[model samples]
Target: MKHQSSEYVVVIGGGFSGLATAGLLAASGHRVTLLEMQDSLGGRAGRLHRDGFSFDTGPSWYLMPEVIEHWFKLMGTSTTVELDLVDLEVGYRTWFQGHPDPLDMTTGPGAVAAFESVQTGAGVALEKYLAYAETSYGLALEHFLYDGFSSVRSLLNPRLPALLPRLAPLLSRSLDSFVAQRFSDPRLRQILGYPAVFLGSSPKHTPALYHLMSHLDLTQGVKYPLGGFAKLVDAMAELCTKAGVKIVTGATAEGIDTVQTGRHTRVDSVRWSDSRGETHRLDASVVVGAADLHHIESRLLPRKLRSSSDAAWKRRDPGPSAVLICLGIRGKLPKLLHHNLLFTQDWDENFGRIRRGEPLDTETSIYVCMPSATDPGVAPAGHENLFMLIPAPTLPEWGTGGADGNGSEQVEAVADAALAQLAAWAGIPDLAERIVVRQTFGPGDFVNNVNAWRGGALGLAHTLGQSAFFRPANRSAKVEGLHYAGSSVRPGVGVPMCLISAEITAKAVNGIKDLGPFSMDGQNRDAREPEGDVQEERVAK
Candidate 1:
């Protein structure tokens, strides 16, 4: 294991994907510098601390443990050593409107019983659905998620044709219809279809291929890094530092300087501004745009060197924007769980409003997280930490937000409605009054802070048109020595996908086209080897 070539690599955006890309490149013997606009490294996976309460500003659920573990192992560490991960006993609690009680979802017999209680023979349907999901998950891990789609031959596996029949329907049909076909109960369908939100899509728009998300939560279960998602961010930042990455926070990337080398335009250096408005330049052999792809291309690079144009981006779905409400309540929320979902009875109408770019609906579905239930460190003693996520349209009409009710009318109104809903549904009528600290983050905040396209909270929606090989490539099609790694790019959204995206980007930078998971031995294996052989090696290890 030696340096492939000591190229200077500049990774823009200090999010999970950015940090992971910087660390992997550094580990592979590249001189790396990571630039983050925020004062902190974590982008969306940010932390908000106020009045002795700490809230994970973005992602909370820790699914896909293997993906997390794989990245840690690659960095010469283990999750057991680096992260104190707690396997949540109850994956999540769901409260459907009009239902008398909430369903606490776990795994095995309990999950079956919960579903069976809702609809006759629904328990059996769940088992069948999960079986398909587990198979799909395994297939994706083996053949799809890891591959960068560098070559058409990357998908020319002998096993693929055999699996195509089973996979075709999943790829073509909407997740909503797929779940509806299996179970007649709306609750069961919601449980199966709700994972679409994680992909920044509604079930109607998201392909059923994403049903594999169910396997990650239902079969494998959910885990939380002990201090909160911020701990995971801390771990990633630490790993990047240990791998010799120079992380510069509060440094905004102004533009990417390029050189026309022969027939290709290559990134020469990145022009950035510091917190004090000091301009600086860093020469690099390669640049990874780990931020929002739309921001990177439209703003940073010159139009001639841009891979995706304004017209191109318009055709793509920027995914759903969200309004995040963080609250520090005065007393314990007995009814709240670490993870909770409040589903509206009319799923079609709720999601339809979002798709049509309508205003936030009165009865929209919401996700609430009470991390204090699992981690005492998040909030002061006797108080509760609450976070509510409402998926809204990417429309600017919703506006931005601030601390202690200092937000635009539309944003605050959504928060107000969420609090009222929580009080009514969770039996906590005084939820609003008990809030000792209140903060709201909306679409405008996403655009202002992260340069999100159209204020989309997540990168791109995982629709049939924007998935897998159809998604944007990691390497720049127009510029040489330019790459991408993040939710906006390949494997899709979520912390785990971002980590995997880093590996894919690293492989492209290393000039290794092996469409399999990179070996932990720090060796670039032959690209010609079947991906199954690599899987076998991992298992044997």
Candidate 2:
């Protein structure tokens, strides 16, 4: 709770992380200014409203409800209006090539019985597996993700040495390998491994430590914030304003001007342009570049002041982008549910083609979200709002049959073919014909709208070496008083991780020192508590 007072902190980007950072800083008695390039806020989590249809354009799955509750509580806001969280009875449905019926997944005691119903003895394994996953999840929030870490030295804490044995899986194994080793059924394996898609990496490439995500999915639960992600955006903006933070939208940040002292260089001010082509420079003592990490570093800051090298960035694995198609249908689609994941048997090949900058796979794996099924207000009466997404490479103009990889025209052709395939696979014979409102956002849209580096829909890829303390640090090593938060920074991608990143960076801004990556819990924990005591708390009632 300790903080630096009376400093003017300028936050670039009005996204979730930026809003959280600005609110935290202002609440700590600092003067904060948040500049967002877009006319409205929400960044990637932006909403689309047209002709009586509303859809969360980016993140649809609302996981980690605790993060939101904790954030609101910390900001001294009432959690009553936080979200009308609905616990999905059927979290999602997955369609496999030859499967007769779709797979229905849920959480808690019933979940154990359900898995056991599918495969003998598998339910017993699930119960035990989730218990293990819960332990990992607790260790994550309590030890590392919530705590501030500036350098590798954070890992040198005394507590970490005792925790090293448990951390070996994160260092040595992958999620897919872990699932394969645990479950025998391929259907169940896919169900367990699908959570990796949120991390924006292949299960084979994601670290095994991320299996805690399974605990979140299977044991904990998936939630939908009534009114979509935009509700959180509204609440966050309101919180920031209440905390006396200035929110400026449609203000595009062009550069971060610096002033060099004897040994360190400090961000002097930020130069930004409004929608009308008017440019202005605002002075600041601290700057939080939360827009896009790579975009800010490569374009906003001077080359000489950048701490990360282009070669180093290239060496790191980037997360998968997407080709998102939001269709407002004219008729009801009973074949789909709140969340549907359609996959071909060639799952690995699908990921391979997408990750390698090749065109989308012939048999693409698609995620179709029909929120209207759960919330009638999201669509017109007797109709469904279909949000379709294909995890794709962040390429220029590349489409299934686009010319030279940059034409939006080719994206339409790609969309048509994919829709036909989706209809056949999902057993919805008239899928394409139901569209009354259509919007296609490809990689080209990603770059133009949010300045996404390489059209990345997710943050940086959560590869082995690119994870944990190895990911980009929240605090800048070269620029004094400059910090970062969001999917691109440490703790990796996802809405929950971004919230944690905001907390970590906020604490750091308030003069909290990084206790290395594995120091004991900093918030509400006795500094003297030994790391050996780290364990999962009881499940929330």
The number of the candidate with the highest lDDT is 1
| Model 2 lDDT tens row, 240-345 | 9987778889888888888989987998888888888888888788899887899989999878878799998888777888878878888888878899987777
Candidate 2 lands at a TM-score of: 0.92
What's the TM-score of every candidate structure?
Answer: 0.95, 0.92
Q: After superposition, how far is residue 226 of candidate 2 from its true place, in Å?
A: 1.4
> Clash number for model 1?
0
C-alpha RMSD of each candidate structure in angstroms? 6.7, 8.3
Q: What lDDT does model 2 reach?
A: 0.79
Local distance difference test, per candidate?
Answer: 0.87, 0.79
RMSD versus native structure for model 1: 6.7
Q: Best TM-score goes to which candidate?
A: 1
